[model samples]
Target: MAALRSREASGVPLAWLIEAVTAGFVDADVSTLLDEREERTARAALPPSFFGWLAAEARVAQAIVSDQNEGDSRVPYREVERAAARMLLEFAYRLMHDDPDRHFLDLPFRFAAPAARLGIESSLVIQAVRVTERRWVDQLLTAAGERAGDIAHSVLSASAAIYDAVVDSFVTDYVVAQAQLDGEMLATKRALIDALLKPGVRDAKGFDDLGIDLSGHHVAVVLWHPTAGIGPHLDTAARQIGMSAFANAVTVVPGDDRTLWIWLTFADDPPPAVLERVRSIPRDPGRVGVAIGPVARGVQGFRRSHLLAREYAAVAGRLPPGIAPDIADTERMSYLSLLLRDPERAEWFVATELGALATGAVSDRENRETLRLYLETGQSLADTAERLRIHRNTVVYRLKRIEQAIGRPIASRRHELYAAALLAHLLEQSES
Candidate 1:
């Protein structure tokens, strides 16, 4: 890049190039130079005929960027054309003046802003500047006939310097513009994600624009590291899990430090223990926290899975050390998880709903335990008694006491209630 800018022939001073760059730029009149060069070489490079052609044919340059903007739905053809025309004219002027930063306030010279706005990546825009400049040089050379050969070397040198300088400026501006757009886009995506977390908050057109789809089966995983950056690690984990488990995955940061919310999408329920693949990555130091939600379908399922994944993290926090489970099969402890989700609220509900049995009385505990066992054993007195190591009459007596304590006859409808209560008790037991 520096070599291109350093190329200067006789009559063109290198110091002037640096000075021109330092002092800003002035638009160069190229047709006037062509007229002078033509006087020396007795050529007609800037003939009346060529000027007439440029008046009409310069519009062709506008289509160049459109060809480069592949698969971009937001291609702004009119703005791109306006910018390209200006860029071509800017190139023509730079060829004469040797001022790289000439036409500073013009739309043609400000190519990078339009490129970035039209969904062009910075790297690609830099390449576009290089390619477009070379093409412009080619057209200029063809336009300037062989009779102008005396000054062709000088013209090429000036063009190369212009090309290098224009490319450098375009690249710098493109990167800065891209960063600003990317920041704005990131904030927009974050807002959309927050909105998408709610039920019935999706817009198909909006999601399509952002390329986010929740209308699929999703298994969500929550991961966090106490120390170290997490995006790269989570990215590695997502890739590993997706490849090994044969599912496509999307990740969301959810604005937590070193935490990642990953959702793996599948045609059906995801494979069992899918996160084990994430845990198996070579970088796995076992320092990262992981919790997984069960597979479910559609938008509701996607939101529910994330909610459950977060809920699993909550449950894990309350669990004892050295037993930080890898998977949080929300399906397994779902009944209990409902209680564990908010211990205080569950406790209040239990106390109010279960009355005396919710108190920790020995006989009440015995009756509640026997009733939980009886229901779990399919109302089998023998099975409940054997599990409790007491006679069938003892099971019957406990059932009567449970019915009285709860102020309701023990029936199929009451099973869900008692099961939730039993799960709460069992979760409490883990604390001991």
Candidate 2:
């Protein structure tokens, strides 16, 4: 039955075969359904080099990836001679199945486990996957005969979408595994601090090593989580999400047990999504204050960004207790951080920008709060009403009051920037 299916699928694109299976038009009988004889023949067709030779090629490929890594990363590649051969055989099986019902990724993560232990960049692990895929296709072309016609047909015709999904999962697994490896607690807090602060303070060692990626761009995150029952570790939550999102190790160090300092490093400028995560974190009731540093590189970049995140945390710390957890603008937080760094200066700026409305009095503060929410709701009257749980007419009333007091149209660009600055000041205020 399986052999009959394989014969019928001979020249069909893998996509169409998979679609037929998915659409319920065919029974994929993937688990041992395929003709065993044909599967064996396909695997047998590959040259000896595609298996044993594959390891040699992987070694060279891993070397190139290692060489291209950050200049200061002294990590060395572990040998994969035996493992690469296993991966080749596995790849051959995956290629021959070409049937959606029987399709499984069969990527060689276990083969790379040795290199993974050496602290090589996860990206390097991904590079090996590409190299393996390319090698498989090359061998397929050279050796394709009647037996491999289906394998050749699918692999060649729709290489892009087919391999994209494979690589995505492969890369996702590599980073998740790296996170699991690093999830084990690191060295003492004081030791990590000293290492990060003073680069040359004694020889660097494992876990104790300057864990920061000196040349990588980073988005530093700080979580000021509540210390009550053994609720979820905010640090762990951040690490898992960061690993999944950025596909790399996001350093999570305890700033004491109640506080966590995390850094997500990237090879280049982060996408908007990364910044949004940083901004959106430290959610409600948690007093989460997040600030992302500008993209920077090297040792200076590491310290500078950490300093910004820490400073951002301090600014959040000063917020009136129970202030909604929120992120200060990454772009604006640069100077705003400086202003809020000193209470008196922040007060002065608030008083200057907000004028009479800057006083911390209840009525003035309420007006300020409305403006903050009003801006946050994207200046939409309906959203502000819904968010504040007040009638839409109440929002209109508040906006009118606010504009009358501030003496400027809320829609003006200048007033908008001022309103943001005013909120920054309010974030630093302690609720009396």
lDDT of each: 0.60, 0.55
Determine which window of 10 residues in candidate 1 has minimal summed lDDT.
Answer: 38-47
Please give the RMSD to the true structure for each candidate, in Å.
10.2, 16.8
Clashing pairs in 2: 282-288, 320-431
Per-model TM-score, in order, reads 0.56, 0.41
**Residue-wise lDDT of candidate 1 within 1-432, one digit each (tens)?**
343245444344332222222222233333432235323332222222323333333345445555666545565555444445445444444554556555532333455766786766666655655676676556555544552475456556756766666576677788888889878876777776677787775434455534545676888877766466566776676566557666765655544766677777776665566655744655454555667787778777878888888887767655645444554556544655776667677777767666778766788777767877777887899999999999999788878878887778778346665755675465556656
**lDDT of predicted model 1:** 0.60
lDDT of 2 by residue, 1-432 (tens): 364366446653332322222232222222131236533453455433233344454565556555556532544333332234334444444444554234443444443344455566666656665676676567555554454565666665434444555556556766676666665424554466546655443323443354555566766666666434223656455654475546344676766656667677777778888766555443454533444556556555666677777776676666665452355445656555665567666565666666667665777776777787777777888987888798989888977887787787777744544555465446545544
